[model samples]
Target chain A: MGEFELIERFFKRPARRSPLGVGDDCALLQPAPGMQLAVSTDMLVEGRHFLSTVDPLRLGHKALAVNLSDLAACGASPLAFSLALALPAANEAWLERFSRGLLALADSHGCELVGGDTTQGPLNICITVFGEVPAGGALLRSGARAGDDIYVSGSVGDARLALEVFRGRLSVPAAVFEAARARLEQPTPRLALGMALRGIASAAIDISDGLAGDLGHVLSQSGVGARVDSVSAFGLLASPGIPVDTALDLVLSGGDDYELLFTAPPSASKAVQAAAAASATPITRIGTIHAEPGLQLVDRSGAVLMRRFTSFDHFA
Target chain B: MGEFELIERFFKRPARRSPLGVGDDCALLQPAPGMQLAVSTDMLVEGRHFLSTVDPLRLGHKALAVNLSDLAACGASPLAFSLALALPAANEAWLERFSRGLLALADSHGCELVGGDTTQGPLNICITVFGEVPAGGALLRSGARAGDDIYVSGSVGDARLALEVFRGRLSVPAAVFEAARARLEQPTPRLALGMALRGIASAAIDISDGLAGDLGHVLSQSGVGARVDSVSAFGLLASPGIPVDTALDLVLSGGDDYELLFTAPPSASKAVQAAAAASATPITRIGTIHAEPGLQLVDRSGAVLMRRFTSFDHFA
Candidate 1:
């Protein structure tokens, strides 16, 4: 079949919720009055983003999930997304499973597959997602204030622990490895939590590049300092039974958590707890923002810990 | 430097016009009141979409230009775009030139750089563009009727001619080759012509995959047919120093001509002419929509020509 026919058979879906979807040169999205459009794009290449042996369905889901994580960080409600994919060849079975995984999450989030281009090449999936938030409502990295409290939703470091297992650097029981693998392969974008925390959180970012690095972004943008409690943050690691020291390292500096790292007013701790409870996502307050302009990690006794670990750098 | 720092140093700009730009989890765009959002995406691979010898600057420009052309087909005004790029390594010189070309075109069209991801991998660029059109004013393939007149903006076939020269399949004089090469490399997305035809044109599509193939999309979507005049279309080929027979084949089915192919009611001929004149892009009347449901090419005496050439099929 031709590219058009292949898309019609596989990617094309009913444009019920969208003003227009797939088949047009450009898809139409009629935004609600006074709402602003939030956009983000992420690309995953085989061997770089995932192993060649990874499940096609999980890969497909992760492609869209990563972009949605960006939306979740901004407190935007999911609207729609476009996927640009390149394949070495047209494989029906692979596409069927992949689309099934991708569309399932999209349906759950009420995000339509708006439009995208698919071509023949080495396998690559690039997803650009569009969401909407009321004007002046989107959470920004620059909104953190000196008195804000730092929090992170969901347990951290399981994804990195999973990668370590995959690399044969660690040994784990089958069940523990499965749990960690699921964490790496099927990250949940904290959409509900983000929407719930919208007016309460002062600033937010998704933790893709570990706590230290991702929080560096918030500090640099907001022109403030942060003192993360190494004791609390390391204690929050859910690394699927990895050794304590290794788990601590992963929690502190490993990447691919896909959890919301945010700041809120110190007095809003109860409100923040309420927001997390409403979304059914657990959150832990691990630090406080400061008027100083750098990041520091503190021990349990409130003494500064000086051992530094770099964030995951794609190109260092 | 890390990927995030690389983006800040090279790709980040003032973002004066956007509601929100880089350094956020997502970029925010406020659409004009009473307007619909138009979105399109395209991905380019190194060896497939362009030659390894292509200029880095030109490659970046072509990448964004193609997505803009899709917006043009919908009669949408340029708004903003997100870029997802994967590179083998961080090369400062290459990035400087690429961003220069990409942002230069973006600035020219008033499209801002929104949000995207950068990673280390095989060189690939995918751009998703957002635009706006009034409700019910978008030009769609399904809008064409049986009795509409067909038109194309700008010249075609020169891009294919340049490809042949690049492949060493054909040779041309130095100056002639340079002119055709420019047509291949730096295609002008007929944005103004598309906007001007918003109310006048019955249907529209950008000719990325040649006249015969791309026009067939319009017919299939509209449930109509088309009969292109081989005499006029072949004559319209602006192949620099190419032989007549080669030009005929290229004009019939050569891809990568980012021109607009459109249809309009017969009575709107004057309005179509006015659009072309106002946009300063030449237009040619080369065919007619028909009740039959297939494409045909007619000779000078209106006799059907049965010869066929396939469009560039990604799978093929």
Candidate 2:
């Protein structure tokens, strides 16, 4: 099939919120008045972002999910997204599964597929997502202040543990492996929690490159330090029976966690809990922002841990 | 350099018209009230889209140029764009030159770099551009009616001719090759003309996958056919000394031409000319829309041409 046929068969949908959608050179979106359009893009290459053994359906879901995670970080409501894909070949079955998974998530979020380009090349999936937020209400990494309470929504480190099993470096029980693999393959973007914390959280970021590394962005941007409870973070790992050191390593440095790490002032503690309850997403207070200029991991007895953890870097 | 450092060193720019650019999970844009956001995305893969031997600068320009051409087709003013790029390695020299070319064109059009993702993989560049048009003012491919005067901005086929030279399929004079190569490497988007033809043109599309194929979209979408003058199209090929058959093939079916192909009413001919003149972009009236449902190519004597031409299709 031709490029147009591929798009028409699998990707095209009638325009809903958009004035024009697929089949147009450009899609037209009218954001509500006084709303700021939030834009983010993520590109996933086969080996770099996903394993070759990954299912096409899961790949599709993960591609859009990662971009949505960015929108979630900004506390933006998903509106629309564009997918630019390059495939090695025009495989009908793979396309069917991929599109089914992609559009399923899109429909659930009310995010319409607007426009994109398809070509013949190495498999690459790039999604640019659009969302809307009230003017000046976007959660940013630079908003954290000293004395702010640091919290993380959902769990982390499970995705990294799943990666280890996939790499054959570790083995786990079948049920545990399946659960961790699911977390790695299909991450849940904390959209509700992000939106709920918009006015409450002083700073927010979705954890992708482990909690410590991603939180480093918040600390550096906000020009503040943080004191993370190492034991508290140890509990963030969902997998059981792992060594303390390895668990801490995965919890602190694992990549592909789509949880949100955010900060709110102590005065907003009650309000933060209320927001979490409203969103039905669990939240855990694991740290506190400090006026100092470095990240400190403290043990249960309040002794600083000397270990260092680095985040994933594409060009490291 | 690490991913964040690479982005900070090269791609990050201060927010200009946008509320945020490049530093956060999402960039925030607030369009003027009553304006529709025009969105388009294009992915350029090495070997498929361009030669590996081509200069990185030209590659960068062509990437953004192609996407801007889409916005132009919709009569939208450039606003902002996000670039998702995957590179095989962190080559500082290449990145410097590429960003220079990309940002130069972006600055020329007043489009800010908002947000995107960078990863380690085989080279792929995906750009998602945003533009703005007044509500109900954006031109579309579904509005062309029978008796509309078909038009083309600038020229076509030269880019394809350049590719032929590169492939050693044809040889031309030094000047001719350079000129054709320029067309291939750095085709200008007819943004001004598209904006000017906002009300004059009934339907429009950017000539990317050759005129015949791209126009087929307008025809199919509008449920109309067209009678294109083969001789008139032959002149669109800027290269001289090429045979009529070869020239016609390139002119009618060549890809990578970022010119505008559009339709306007016979009554609005004068207004179309005025629009073309106001934008200072040359245009040719090459055909007329018909009530019939098949494309017809005619010679100067108005006799139908029996030859068939297929536009570029990635899979085919």
Candidate 3:
């Protein structure tokens, strides 16, 4: 079948939620009145962002999930998104599985598939998501302040552990590897937690490029430093079989964790915890924002640990 | 320099118009109250949509321009857009020219550069543009009705004429080739024309995949047919030096003109003309919508010509 036929059969859906959908040159959306639209775009390439053998179904899920994570960072409610896909060839089986996976997640979040383009080329998936937030309510990196308590929702380092196994640089038990791989392949966006923390959290960011590096963004933007508890950070790892020493490195520097890392005033600690429980996600207070301008890791004795903020840089 | 530094030096701009811009996880936009958001995405692969020999500056402009064309078809005013770029390397010179071209057109249309992702891969550019139109005012392809006068804005076929020369299948005079080449590389998005046609147009579409094939979309969706003027379509060709026969073929099926094609009632002809005059874009009556469900082309003798509606299909 032709490109148009493929899209009609697989990607096209009724514009029930949106004002218009796939058939038009442009899709129409009516954002809630008085709310500001939040927009973000993310692109994932084969081999660079995923394994060549990944399930197309899972790939679709991850593609939308990653962009949703950005919305969560901004405390925005999903409205709609567009997909720009480049494929080597139109494989029906792959398209079927991929669309099913993508549509299911999209429906769950009420994020309508608004519009997109499909072209012939190397496999690449780019999604631009639209969302909404109340004016002045978006949690920004520049809002973090000294004396704010930094926290992370959900476990970190599991995805990194999975990457190590995929790279053949480390070995783990089969069950452990499978669990870690799931973390890497299918991350749940902390949408609920993010929305809940909007009025409570001072600043927020989703962890795609490791906790240390992402938090560094908050620090740089807010003109503050961080004093992280290395032991507490490593203790938050989900891998019970792996020793803390090894997990510590992954927890500190490895990437691909979609956890929400945020800061709240010391007074709002209870609210932060309540937001976590409300979202059914765990919250860990691993660091504190400080006036100094460098990220410092400290052990229980309060001695600083040597650290370098090394996150995944696509060009690097 | 790191990713953030590169972005700052090259892409960072003062958020003059958008509610919030580049540094955030998601850019925020406040659409005018009661307006619907118009969104579209298009991706350009290095070897697919454009040639390696084309100027990087023009390539950047075309990438965003194609998406803007979609908004124009919808009769939406330009708002904001995000860019998802995948590059083989972070070449400073190429990026400098690219950003310059992209930002210049965006500025011209008052479209803001919002948030997006950048990574390393085969060179690819994906842009998601957002716009706004009054509720129920968008000119859609499905609104064409029987007896509506079909019209095309500006010239056609020049881009296709340029493509033939690039393919080395034909050659023209140096000046003629340059003019055609410019059309191929930098065809204007008829944004003002589209916005002006808002209440006057019964249905509208952008000529990305040639006049005949793209108009088929209006016919198919509207459940009507069209009787096109073959002579007038050829006359609309901008290639003054090209032969009529060659121009006829190019105007009919060559892609990437980025012109607005629409239908209006005979009663609204005066308004359509007025809109064209206000927008400073020429409008040509090329066809009429019919009750039947097939696109029909007729010569000066008024005998129907067989039309297959062949357009650019990515997987074809």
* Estimated TM-score for each candidate: 0.97, 0.98, 0.97
Clashing pairs in 1: none
> Best to worst by DockQ, what's the order?
2, 3, 1
**Tens digit of lDDT per residue, candidate 1, span A220-260?**
99999999874343422443455666676788787888999
Q: Which stretches of candidate 3 lie over 4 Å from their true place?
A: A230-243, B230-243, B307-309
Which lDDT value does model 3 have at B166?
90
TM-score of 2: 0.98
Displacement of residue A171 (Cα, Å) in model 2 is 2.2
Error of 1 at B210 (Å): 1.0
Interface RMSD of 3: 0.9
Model with the higher DockQ, candidate 2 or 3: 2
Query: For candidate 1, what is the lDDT?
Result: 0.87
Sorting all predicted structures by TM-score, with the top scorer first, yields 2, 3, 1
Model 2: residues with Cα > 4 Å off, grouped in runs:
A230-240, B233-239
Give the per-residue lDDT digits (tens) of candidate 1, residues B196-282: 999999999999988888898899899999888843434224435556666777887888889999999999999999999999999
Error of 3 at B120 (Å): 0.3
Give the CA lDDT, 0 to 100, for residue A16 in model 2: 92
